[model samples]
Target chain A: MRDHLAFRLAYRGTAFKGFQFQKNVVTIQAKVEEAFARYFKESRRVHFGSRTDAGVHAYDHFVYFPKAFELYTALGVSKRKSFLSSLNFMLGNDIRIWEFGRLSSNFNVMEDIVSKSYSYFILSSPVEDPILTEYFHWIRHSLNLRAMRKAQRQILGTHNFACFAKSSGVSVRNSERGTTRRIYKASIVSRLHPQMKIGQILEFKFEGSGFLRHMVRNMVGTLVQVGEGKGTNIKSILRSGSRLEAGPNLPANSLFLTGTKIRAGLYAPLRPQTE
Target chain B: MRDHLAFRLAYRGTAFKGFQFQKNVVTIQAKVEEAFARYFKESRRVHFGSRTDAGVHAYDHFVYFPKAFELYTALGVSKRKSFLSSLNFMLGNDIRIWEFGRLSSNFNVMEDIVSKSYSYFILSSPVEDPILTEYFHWIRHSLNLRAMRKAQRQILGTHNFACFAKSSGVSVRNSERGTTRRIYKASIVSRLHPQMKIGQILEFKFEGSGFLRHMVRNMVGTLVQVGEGKGTNIKSILRSGSRLEAGPNLPANSLFLTGTKIRAGLYAPLRPQTE
Candidate 1:
């Protein structure tokens, strides 16, 4: 039990390429791993539930690190917490580490994730808000919520979502290899922010076994089209996987990776994710 | 009212200095006047609060242009909103025309202002939000709310805050003239953003007749120090308006030109200043 570790992390996506590693571009995975490497004084390998694309965000994300790993064995609570605390101090501002806890050796972030969900907020208002201009998708015209819901229903049960994934431009073989069974839990709910900007915020909560690359964002774009009275049969688009093209992806600033469903007997506490 | 003309403005403070358009460097006043001159196709005049510093921001802050002035009469609303909008729009995101409304010739954003108010929000948590980073100050330790409030009382009455205003290198003589202020209300409120990376935000609201240059920021800095257990005698601090050569200055990003106080009979609504 003492040979494993789990970290609950949350980050603003604006400054990161995504939760994975990449050169030149700043990615969340790179930063967090670097911190872990420094703290344990040796490299500790890590894993996450989803591979969020560049500009994606996480609310209560999790990371798993192995204890058999040589890096972190001798560390005490103050040293561990201090490592995180100092990273925040040194990194200065762009990212923050919330809290960490030791996990059982066999825990896996991806396999244990029960459901992975996302919420996309669109600020469809004519006026530019003095405050909220950064974190939302700003649309000028009103969107049709009912129509959008109708189109959203087309993506419910497990289907090969090869049509929804981004083609890496590698034309060779099986496009279907990337996907696993996924269930669309519920229709999106659209509401206005109560305090300041009077605009529409569309939220989609999906609890699924897993996800495909760009699948959620593409689905949202197609749904937004229906909401804007732009189209009708998105199911047919999915069936043939024909067009191989998606409409304008709403900006990543508004999309939030809210929660991840994890295995219960595994016992991961509800805490902010590591940096 | 039929002859009313709207204008878009841009300025490089590094050249003329701040928005006030001084002779020392490029003042915002001169740059704005230049834009209005080109828009009117001549050197027509306009009026604003004459505040805001170098590198400050404004989305659709307003200024009154005389209705009888025939300078921009040739330009239509679509052309005006579009052309001027494009000028800033083409320049980049840093510049935007938040909105425009036509008003009577008597409109004065300064004299007509009934409530002149500003806000400073600090990310008073150990975690720094990457997304909301540019919008708030991140303080590592918990603040002394009691001390902040005690200091706030000193901000209530009309006083010459000369010590608070930073000398603009330009050092305009009499710049501190008649700078006594009556703070209508001053208080701190904590806003909890559920999805925000940071746990809680502390905001300071300051409403006064008007402010000296960098007055609010300098005052906010002193208060933050008091809250952090670094300072004493907030009143004595305010009385020494000759500028603290080493006084702590709070971050400006968290500071906002939230609102203005104007005379009751202006075209746009403004809060009335009170003792």
Candidate 2:
């Protein structure tokens, strides 16, 4: 059996093209693999739990490697500080590995059966936030939070999400495999962060069995439109299963994969319901 | 009388060397002046409320320019959007101008008699926070919050702060001006941010009449040392008035000038004090 290691990682995603490796463009995968090579003096392919798009952040994404455990054992815990700290020191400031442990050879981050949670941050402000520009999607007009919360409830069930998925690159064979997926939780939270110039933060959290390409972004966009009074027929849109009816896919920078397991309890319930 | 314009500005200080104009490197002053040149079709020097050091962010710093009111009058309220919005559009994502109004020509942002507040964020985490690297200073060891809080109390009220101020480039003639200054408020607050991988944020807030060069950073560093049990005699540190006696000056990135006026109310009180 191949010795493997599993780790929980976080990254800003601002400097990276995406999580995947590409020939020339800088990417999270490429930087991570480069760090591994330098540390162990051997090349290793790090497999990420999700192939996130460019500008999509991950606060609790997983990474698996074939020989990470062996390298850690070779270094020996008693000889140095934490393996996570050692790896983090070599990696750039934009990425960090927070937790790590040996995994059974048969386990795969992508194949693990579990749900994942993501949070999308939106700033409702006329003035831009200099510090938060990289982290939030700023919408000048005020959002009707109550309407958005009500719309998200419609998302909490197993349904054919083909209307929300990006279909351009999906294989024809996979399309027939069915686009139905179960959503465990969905909610929108509004918060006042005084320190931020754009003080109003609208956070949207979605947890589901699995997501198709561009599914969450499209869902967020559609819900935002509903909140803005542009799309009122959410039920009809779902039943029709037409991609064209969904809202435009929002930007990737505001989306963050926050948790993998349902019980991770990374986020609390949205408080003081917005009216 | 010449007409002037006043505005509140915010910036992420990661890119620029500092707030003031420099010969070659990019600075906030240079960028603001450049924007003015573009809009007014004339060269104008933008005056700032404070000369911030490298990597220090400002949320409520002021800026003023002569003939700004004249330009606004020319545009009128109907023809163009507010000068603040126009300037923000031309500036990079790291800086934003949020508020603007006409001011009498005699007004000077620097001479305004008001208190200014600054907050320094420190992440008490063994591992780094990828997304917050630019926003916080990461400390690995556990800190004694109670001890730091006690040290901050000593920081309150007026005192000769020579021990905390950096003396190296200070003019020899200005040394006799006396290093004593009034500190209106000082405290350390801890918070748990779920979105940040480094959950513990120890925010240090300091408000006073004015700060000497590197004053806040050096004070925070000394307090951190006290919290770590390395320095115990806070009284001696104050009495010695020797810069060498204080702890190392902390990095500049964690420091943020939060507000220029106490009544601006940009920050809320620390809730449920840390033990």
Candidate 3:
């Protein structure tokens, strides 16, 4: 029987190329796997809940390591804390494993995820905010929050999102799942940036069944165009299903994978199990 | 007769070696000077109200360029806005000249200053915050706010802050102005970090006549020691006047020069005089 160790991760993605393992470049998955190999004295295949692009941050992300039943059982409850601390020490400052538990052998990180939410921050100000350069997409022109919110309503519910997705020529066409996606909620709200005396942060939040490649960023880009009085028709763009019809893709730095939810009872407390 | 153009500058000092111009390494002063030279087409000496160390941010730092009256006068009120925009384009995203005007020829940036205030941010949390990596110093152990506040009171009032200053071998011994300085206010306050769900930010604020090199950082470090139950005696450390008595110097990235108050009525609006 195979047992899996599931963990929750939070990371600042500035230094990382992306969440996935890539050749000749540093990535979050590569670092996590490296740390896991060092700790367990062996290599194990790790599964991520979602793959985030480069410079994207995560408040809560899920990952699982397969075939770890025997090794994890030996550590027991007392060693778990030290194990996590050591792993975090190895992972460095950019990534942190905040929570971990035992996953049922049947649990699949990709298929089991029920929902995912993301937040994109925009600093709408005449002057660029130096401190928020990494976290926010600075816009020199003031954003019209009301217009963006109005346009945000159009993105809610099920729709064909090919206009917002990257054109993956053959794969997307051949895949069972098309460009259609269901957005549970989409909203835009403005808040005073904590650090900056001037300017407000426009938070664009989206909760969905799943997101296509560059979907959220493209949606935000379209909404930003509406805010900028660029006359973006989100409804028409959705219907057209043409990538060229959508707004420009926003940068990944300001994007955040804020939440990921999985089916309950799939995770068990990490402890020594007596058969 | 040298007329001055004064400006309020804000910058994230992560990329800067320091505020002062040094050979080879990039500094805030060097960047600003480069921008000035690019815009004005002449090498002009710039004066800073304070010299902050590497990775130290500033929200409201003051700077002045003497003999800039002619160039500034030529660019009438109509052209000033465009000029500022052009200069900001040259300065890039990390630094900004938010406000600028003319300074009276008699107004001395060093002597005419009323007070300066600085704030240091500390993230007291078990896990490191990745997004705030450049802006805050993360401490794993929980800090005792009450203990820190009690110790902060000892920093108020005038005293020889030799313990908090960097050792300047010949300068301290021969300078007419000694290490004695008056601190107007010293306080510590806790706030919920806007970005983080887990950690609370402890802000240490100091307002004083003048600060010695590394003074604020050393003071914060000693206070952190007190919070950690290290039994730091601020009074004794101040009395000792020995740098060794103080706690470790905190990282410069967490320190910010928040305010610089110059003498009132010293600034004149940037305009071509009707006379």
Worst lDDT 10-window in candidate 1 chain A:
A168-177
Give the Å error, residue B133, model 2. 0.6
Candidate lDDT (C-alpha), each: 0.62, 0.77, 0.83
Q: State, as a TM-score between 0 and 1, how close model 1 is to the true structure.
A: 0.79
lDDT of 2 by residue, A1-275 (tens): 74676667789887799889989999989988898888778898997557788989998886778756766767765533555666777787888877666666666444453788899998877777888888899887677888888888988898878788885334546644367778999988887758643447889999987787888999999998987878666667777777888888999999998986622222222111101
Error at B85, model 1, angstroms: 4.4
Native-interface RMSD of candidate 3: 9.2
Candidate that scores best on lDDT = 3
Residue-by-residue lDDT tens digits, candidate 3, B1-275:
77788877889989799899999999899989999999989988898769999999998898999878678778767676577668888998789876678788988765788889999999887667777768889887788889989999999999998899986311555434578878998888787655445557888999998888899999999999998899899999998989999998999999999888888888764421211
What TM-score, over all chains together, does every model reach? 0.79, 0.86, 0.88
Compose the digit string of candidate 1's lDDT tens values, residues A1-275: 45456666677787777878878777877887777666556666577767777777777666767663223446676665565576556444566656555566666654667777777766665433434656667666677888887777778887766666666322335333355457758577777643222456667666566667676777777777787787657777767664364444557777777766567766544344322
Model 3 CA deviation exceeding 4 Å by range: A1-3, A67-70, A76-78, A105-112, A168-177, A192-196, A268-275, B1-3, B76-79, B168-177, B191-196, B268-275
Kindly indicate the candidate among 1 and 3 with the higher TM-score. 3
Maximum-DockQ candidate: 2
Question: Local error of candidate 3 at A89, Å?
Answer: 2.9
Ranking by lDDT: 3, 2, 1
Sorted by DockQ, highest first, which candidate order results?
Answer: 2, 3, 1
Q: What is the TM-score of chain B alone in each candidate?
A: 0.73, 0.87, 0.92
Interface RMSD of each: 9.5, 13.6, 9.2
